[model samples]
Target chain A: MVNMLSIKNLHAGIEEKNILKGLDLTINPGEVHAIMGPNGAGKSTLGYVLSGRDGYEVTEGEATLNGQDLLDMEIEERAVAGLFLAFQYPVEIPGVSNMVFMKESVNAARIARGQEEYTAGEFLKLAKEACKQVQLPLDFLKRGVNEGFSGGEKKRNEIMQMILLQPSICFLDETDSGLDVDALKTVADGVNSQRSPERSFVVVTHYQRLLDYIKPDFVHILADGKIIKSGDASLALKIENEGYGFLGLNYVEEKA
Target chain B: MSQWLEDVIAHAEQPASNELAATWLAEQRNSSLKKLKEQKWPTRRTEAWANTSLVSVESRNAKPTPANITSWDKPAIPGLDSIDIYFVGGQLKTDLSTFTLPEGLSIYTLQDEKAEAVAASRFAQIKPERHIFGLINDAIANSGVVIDVAENAIIDTPIRLIHLANDGVENHSRVLVNVAKHAKVTIIEHGVGEEDSVNTSMSEFDVADNATLYHYRFALFTQKALHVGGCHFQVGASSYINSTIVAFGSDLSKLNIDVNYTGEHSNVDINAMYLLAEGEAFDLQSTIEHAVPNGTSNEKVHGIIGDRARANFGGRIHIHRDAQKTLAQLNNRNLLLSRRALINTKPELEIYADDVRCAHGATIAEIDDESLYYLLTRGIPRSQALIMLNFGFIQELINDIEIDPIRAWLTDMLSTRFKSMEVS
Candidate 1:
């Protein structure tokens, strides 16, 4: 079967410096892949390069989503083609309400896919359900997009958006950071609930605490811009206990 | 001064047999005419008119269109039951005798016998003498109306003042509104014209003690029309006044909004929004005076300038010595959609009272790249995302409008404007 996401010899960086050097990974449909990395390991750069974010230069790489070239499309076009990136720091749009923003986003994606757009009532119903799934209040839908939202709330809002958009491939960039025990579980549950045979997840995290809630089918240790080791879920527990000291690698403590 | 000013003076000096010229306004007009003569026309060197030019108003040679010759399309506010008064070509086109007003409410032309007494105290008094066009308006404005709301009366139906002018016409319009003690009323001043025309539209509102006033001023002229107007309010003690202003730029358009706190414990909220595109220009000057103790005022001015359009805003808050407990805040924020677009913003606070709380801030910014990318990442097209982000900056104030119909109408109009500005 064709992989859900295939990245081969991916060498990318922001601006002049190269970060990802010959990084290779493949995610099959319905599989959960956890990428464990230290600071400056180029884990997040992979997501940015695939999403076609401006300034993220793909120096040498071949990244595809379901056999389609992801690097050649616009950021919005990639999003419409079932690519979702849950930002580590979501931006705040002060005047655009969350509901209106999501409506436009979802409708745009639907139209690009040749599907009928959701009516106002239909969109609201879907949004409310997604809001509830992530433990966000319904009123958050009425507030400005992530305006004045707490760190945990913003993370949950991203999950809420992912739930509503229903993209095929999701890249969770350090989503487990800055979240409390309760919020981490809420986010993990939100992600786990969406797991299906047709959807894939690439969860990038520094700590293994989140892996306890959402089990990963495979775990890879990314160090020095490349994945040096790959194992099953047990490898995450070993890192939690050993802290990368056995591999002669330095482990940067998670940020508070 | 250009020949336009000279011609206006000559026209004001010419004798007329109109019934309005025979009223007490005649004396006030003569005094204003004297001031207009003494006052030098504003130039780029003038402080108040620094960023705005009077070239269009000074060069236009549009003859006043004959009254009753032009057809006026009255604007409607969806779901708003309002008593409409139409003014076309500087003349009252609405037949007031056809509709009965609400209880304790009165509306009449300035030529009516009751206006002589009203004009004596309010003709040109509320508006400051600093504006040369105001003086010109006082001298040449012959078509006007006076509105009165009795004490303790609550007028549910809004009074809409609609002004329209044909192309190549010079129209001067005026309105005076008096809300007595303990009364409440809603007044909307709506003007629309986009021709090679000149309009000096002015209105003065006197809100008495313990009263409430909801006011809206929509300056919807664009292209070749030259509009110079002012809305002045004297807020009484223990009263509440909420005023909202929405304006689009024209060949030359300027608006002055002055709120004077005449009584203690009064509150005034002034929210102004302007959108200018192409070669349009809009100048907005708002001043709030706290002359008494325990008064509060808030002013929020937001604008979007696109293409080569230019916008200027001057917000001044003055607290007097006796206003020990005054609280005032003014914030002006602008967004320039193009590198060629320009915005000149100045926020000033003059406080003599040491114990008062006052703050002012102004900011001119471009569309945030992070915010734009955030929206784009959500699968919204670049153009749609651009509009969403642009309109987001103005939606805060539009959401503050208490009138639903007005808010909806403004949102639709501004969205259309944003789409045009972005697509081009």
Candidate 2:
């Protein structure tokens, strides 16, 4: 069995501050990995570095997706290569309708992969089904992309895009942070419905509540730019009860 | 002063044998020529023309006579339905035009005795001395249109005016619109031409009490063309007026628009959008005066400049002491796509009334990188992402357009323009 995502000795930072120092992680196909850490443990930085976000410099790292060099690809090219990053804070793009944005994104990715493009009708059908699955109103398709959307709606929109793109490696960067109980379930169900033998997800969150909905096969405790410990799903339950104190790590709230 | 001013005065001194030109038109023309000669051409030293330079147009002589324009294909705006009035080389093409006036609406050329008389009587409403372009237009304009809408009448369709400029010709055009009390109408003016041409045009609108007018102007000249135009509006009591100007594709263009509220409780909304690329220059000066009490006005100007293109926006809102309870707002937003592109935006508010609400704002910024990155993360290429963001910035004003076909047509035109800029 091959690893869908592999990172070793990964070091990244923004500006002069180093966030991820010598971080190592592996996400095998069909496995859901949760990364829980104390505030400044570089959880989000790891996700951003993997997704090629600007300002997040990867000083020393080896990251691959399906054995391909992820560091060498452009931001959009990385997206085209079946890497999806559901942003914690999705951006608001006014005037570009959600339907148009989704169509262009899906078609661009497909064209980049040398696959057949989706017709308008076909794309509409697929988008409608995806919206239904995410429990979002169909009228949202006509509105601007994430413009004036509520917090929960934005999260659901991210999941909707994730489902539509059907990436091989998914990075859920705190998707459950601001969502309510119902929204969390809706997002979890959307992720579960798309789960396949060839799909993998790296779910990063501070709380273990999301793990109750989307069961993870492995739990990693990241601190000070590196993963210090790894265990099974039971380890997340232990952290939820005892917090990071049991691991002898001080928990300072990350100011972002 | 440059030779263009002398040529303009010489052209105005020539005599004509028309009955309409013998009365007030002749005196007004003489007075405007005197004013133009005394004032000379506006330069950077002038306060109003501080940010705009007319050096390029100072030396070019005006074409006194209308060019002999041959028969050409009738111009059409995709998805627009209107009563078409066509002009070629500053000459009205009555043969190629079609006008079917509905009840209480009349359209006539300035050559008609009755129309010229009507225009002459209303000539005092617009002060040509305020602008050099207006003065020149008033002195040499030979072809124009006069439209009158009767009281309580509402024209459902827009009246379209199309002007096609001839190569190396200096064209002067004028438009006079009179709307009676409780009447409503819409007018759309478009200019399209090829080659090097100089055009100076003026439009005066008289909106009566309780009447409404929607005026839209689109200046789509060629790269080598220079356009100078003016719009003067006198809004009456309780009337409503809305105006939008979209300017693009001119080597150097300047538009001066002024609105005066003569009656209480009138409302005016003015919006303008301009796109310039590849060494193009555009200047827009708009002034809204709340001369009477209980008037409301809003002005917005947006521009996108790219590739060393230059743009200027001067928005002025004036509230007189008698204009109490007036509510006025002015905003100018500009986006520069390249480091070389330059934009000068100024919002001026002169208020003497103690009990009025007046506010103004101006902003010039490049495209937001965070927004660009957000789009890029969605698998959209850099160029396509830029085009999307640029269009999105101007979509607010586009949404204000009530007509569906015109809105769709403008969206298509703007997207095409964005793509061309990206290519260059």
Candidate 3:
């Protein structure tokens, strides 16, 4: 059982503030890992660091996707190397249509992997199916990317991209934060449909409601930039029942 | 006076070889020349021309030459089926042109006796007090066109005006469009010039009551060429007028557009897009005036500048005291592709009417890094992402074009320009 994504002593920070302090995690293929944490626990920072976003410097750490160093690659390079981060707040681009953006993204990834590019007709066919799967109308493809979209729709749009790109490692950063029950279920179902033996997922959430639908194989409680506790699915249920207070964890800010 | 002003006056005085000028036209040209002699060319000292300089155009030393009508192939615009009219070296090429005017629509050269009367009347309406370029164009224009659409007539095909200039020559042309009451028409003015040539053109539109007019201008020239042009609109009661100007490729280009609502309930839409790269300079000065009540006007200008290019946009909207219920909006949005690229945009709204709704906004910005990163996270490279964002910025206005062929041609032109810029 090889680890699809491995992070060891991942000390990452934004500007001068250390957020991810000495974090360590290993996600194996076909496994869903949920990272639950209290407020300011660096849950979103972990996702940003993994996807190679700017402003997040990995001070001292090792992060790899299938043994390839992720921290050394450009943002687009990391994306082509099978790392996808579902942003908590998807950006609204006013002029680029969803269809055009998706086609370009898909083709760029394919070309990077030495695969043949999809023709317009072929891309349209695939995008239509993906839109249907996400319960988004086909007309959404013609509109600007996420422009004037509802919160639930944006979350679902992120899922649609993840499904289309089919990256080996997916990071969902607080995707369920503003979603209602129906939206949550839809997003969870979309994630479930993409679960495969060769794919891995890192679901970062502050609440345990999403974990109930996705059913992560491992649950890690992140506190103060590190995973302070690790357990099976029952840990989530326990945290939902007793809250982070019951764990008796003291969150001390780490100085760089 | 400067050498440029002297040369311009000399060029205007030596004209009239093509045909006998009508009495009204001769008077108009004489008055314009008198005004030109009294005033020098617009310089940086002028408020409207502060961001633009005429030094390059003045130094070109291009003189008005006799018409060198060469046998040339008809220019083709992809996806466009239009009545093509060609003017080469500032002279109308009737043998090379092809057009069959439908009933109720008439087209003629300014030299024709039938067109001279209408041209003279329209020429008299242009005020030469402020616009030096308009005065210069009227004083020395060697070739021009007059198009008239009869009352209640609707012409489906666009009337295309193609002006091609050769090097070391000054090409001055004019166009007069008269849309009768309850009529509809579209006109496309396309200009291309060789390196180091100078092009000065002016077009006037008379839109009558209950009439609609669509005017599109595409100016593409070499890097060494200079383009100076103007478009004026007189909109009547309940009439609708739409004009779009697309400027790409030139050393120095300046366009002055004026729209005046003469009757109540008249509406005007003025939109322009300029794409400049590598030593290019473009300046647009537009004014929309609402004289009567219930007038509406909208003006939008978008610019993309790259590689030391400079773009200037000045839009002014005026509502008179009696022009109550006037709704006017002016917006100028610019995107700078490189650090050295410069953009100067100003939107001015002067409303004397208490009940008018007039708003103006101007913004100059580079592509957002967050948006670029968002696209990069989806596997698109930085360069491609920039192109997408840049295109998207201009596409907002391009999408409003209802003509399929014209829209397609513009999209192709923009993409080609983008690709060329990427390589350089």
Q: Which rank order by lDDT, best down to worst? A: 1, 3, 2
- The total of clashing pairs for model 2 equals 0
Judging by DockQ, tell me the better candidate of 1 and 2.
1
Q: Which TM-score value belongs to model 2?
A: 0.84
Chain A TM-score compared with the true chain A, each model in order: 0.97, 0.97, 0.96
Clashing pairs in 1: none
Query: Which residues of candidate 3, in runs, are more than 4 Å off?
Result: A1-3, A7-25, A36-42, A57-63, A67-73, A93-157, A176-189, A206-213, A219-249, A253-256, B15-24, B67-75, B96-99, B338-340, B380-390, B415-424
After superposition on all C-alphas, the RMSD of every candidate to the true structure, in Å, is 4.1, 4.3, 4.1
Best by TM-score: 1
For candidate 1, give the lDDT of residue A237.
Answer: 93
lDDT (Cα, tens digit) per residue for candidate 1, span B1-424: 8778887787788776233464678888888999999999889999999999887777655353235535756778788889988777788877877979879898878777776665678878988888888898888776788898999999998899987777777678889999999999999999888977788889999999999999999999899888999999999999999999999998799999988888899999988999998999999998888889999998889899999999989988888999999989999999888999999999999999999888889988887888888888889998789878877658789999998988998988887888788423
Against the reference, the lDDT scores of all candidates come to 0.88, 0.84, 0.85
Can you write out model 1's per-residue Cα lDDT over A1-256, one digit (the tens) per residue? 8888999999888769888999999999999999997787888888788888888898897999998998889999999999999999999998789999999999999999899999999999999999999999899999999999999999999999999999999999999989999999999999999999999999999888999998999999998889999999999999998988776797665343
Off by over 4 Å in 2: A1-3, A6-26, A36-42, A56-69, A92-157, A176-190, A206-213, A219-256, B15-24, B61-65, B69-75, B96-104, B150-153, B380-390, B419-424
List, residue by residue over B31-89, the lDDT tens digit for candidate 3: 88887788766778888779888887765554765468686446577878888887777
The DockQ score of candidate 1 comes to: 0.67
TM-score of chain B of 2: 0.95
